[model samples]
Target: MDTILWIIAAIFVIAGVVTIVRGGLIYGIVLIVVGLLIGPGGVSVFS
Candidate 1:
């Protein structure tokens, strides 16, 4: 479960970075925030 959360968080963060690079500021920030919240090391919404 932790591993899965980590992978999902990583993907979200990476996608957020890519979105920011592509000129999406708000969406990217939201994605990053959500990623952090869902991460096992962070808030872990699932846990």
Candidate 2:
């Protein structure tokens, strides 16, 4: 479970970085938010 979350987080982080570098701040923010949500230590997961 943790591993899966980590993988998803990693992918999102990478995507967010790419989007940011590509000047897509909105998309990067969205991806980062989604990544945080998908992370193992996120609020939803904690609750």
Candidate 3:
């Protein structure tokens, strides 16, 4: 389950980056937030 969540989080993070690069900052932020919430390590992913 944790692995699955991690994969999903990775997808969201990638999408967020793509969105940000396209100038969709709000959408990117939203995706990143959701990704973190659903991620295995949560905020620790950044650490």
Give per-model TM-scores.
0.94, 0.80, 0.85
Q: Write model 1 residue lDDT over 1-47, tens digit each, in one string.
A: 79989999999999999999999999999999999999999998887
Error of 3 at 15 (Å): 0.2
- Candidate 3, backbone clash total: 0
lDDT of 2 by residue, 1-47 (tens): 78888799879978998999999999999998888888887744543
Ranking by lDDT: 1, 3, 2
Give the candidate order by descending TM-score: 1, 3, 2
Q: Best by TM-score, which number?
A: 1
Q: Which scores greater on lDDT, model 1 or model 2?
A: 1
- Model 3: lDDT of residue 29: 93
- What lDDT is reached at residue 35 by model 1? 94
Best by lDDT: 1
